[model samples]
Target: MFLTQTVPRQREIIEVLFRNGWGYMRKLLTGGKPEDPQLPTPAVLKKIFIDLGPVYIKLGQLLSTRPDILSSAYIEELSTLQDEVPPVDWSEVEVLIRKQLKRPLEETCKYLNPVPVA
Candidate 1:
């Protein structure tokens, strides 16, 4: 387990930016467009993540580990935030795994059971 520090000041800054940016964009998109039916929920979440910037997203993710800080409702909603971030390509994953494990991917997992029930 790892212990991490919280920079509440940074979090507050990011929250302010995210809230303001989100409000501005939301209003622009939704204003006078009552028939637009709104953007998809996942789209809204991803947009919020983008507007909030990286620090808030990281903080939210970290906060999910601490139930004592945020209420369960907020945590649940924060957990739903998709960071609008693309994953490393599969080729990159292979390269990183090989580099970290100092072995070919096949060699590292060759003898491992396909399914290990915990």
Candidate 2:
């Protein structure tokens, strides 16, 4: 049943893994073009956990402290994870801001960056 439902997303998942320079995993997933200078694996892992949602976020939080299981650099990166809502595109954020404030994003703040700071 799980396989039936998620078969559609399998391609997406594999592409994500491969693009993250996890291409060794391609045998288990669809092909993807690797990004040059490849994204930091820790950041990629963080994004995956965030995409997987809250329960996984909680798991990430716990795993962040397990130095024996992950490398120091990975632990440092994982430690930055927070159990907050995942990030969305700035356009969606602008829409939400306007809906809640009942005003355009330009009117509410002195400055708004088109892209969020990571």
Candidate 3:
């Protein structure tokens, strides 16, 4: 399905996989099977997720919770995958919130904090 769709980040994702030495993933994406399938090291897998950006970082975080699927080493490594993005200014966030709300911000809440805690 991904191969059929025109995903904007497809090329970047593939490049990151290749750069991280994830040959198994590259083969899977290109509809090929490796003679000897090999997974990347836990650290390398974490690096791949980090290089792929926020979405992949979140996926890795989710995967970290599944002990049945991933080994302790992988879970340990993925658990540390955090999105290191800079916080958006409150002004920009307020504008987006205002656009989403049916009424004014003042009407919706008595006192809404502009600063982001998380």
Candidate 4:
């Protein structure tokens, strides 16, 4: 993850891990009752994935396919993983495309939609 992510995103991931640890600690300290309602089991996993972002969602998908490695219940929950990304503004996509291709998007494609393919 550190290899693939920019510095700020790596920091964000570590912060999420700390948040999860604190969540568990709060549960333990209060004997399972908390100010906020406790998350359901699947909700906790989903929260973790949503915080971590797309790469982790892809990792969860890969893990979900390994029935021998995970119990049926866990596999079932993980199979629900989605990237949960909002659509990027086309301007950002154009920037990314230009950076990768080292040319303007118009130069590379005869036709390009401002909206992403989804």
Question: After superposing candidate 2, which stretches have Cα over 4 Å from the reference?
Answer: 27-40, 83-118
TM-score of candidate 3 against the unseen true structure: 0.59
lDDT of 1 by residue, 10-47 (tens): 56545654464545445554554344333334334544
Compared with the true structure, what per-residue lDDT tens digits does model 2 show for residues 30-53? 455544533348877877767655
Every model: Cα RMSD to truth: 11.6, 8.7, 5.2, 6.7
Better of 1 and 3 by lDDT: 3
Q: Which candidate should be chosen as best, given TM-score against the real structure?
A: 3
Q: Rank the candidates by TM-score, best first.
A: 3, 4, 2, 1
Q: After superposition, how far is residue 11 of candidate 2 from its true place, in Å?
A: 3.3
TM-score of 2: 0.50
Instruction: Name model 1 segments beyond 4 Å from true.
Output: 1-49, 82-118
- What are the TM-scores, per candidate, against the unseen true structure? 0.31, 0.50, 0.59, 0.55
Of 3 and 4, the candidate ahead on TM-score is: 3
Candidate 4 local distance difference test against the native? 0.68
> Candidate 4, after superposition: displacement of residue 13 in Å?
1.0
Between candidates 1 and 4, name the one with more favorable lDDT.
4
Quality of model 1 by C-alpha lDDT: 0.54
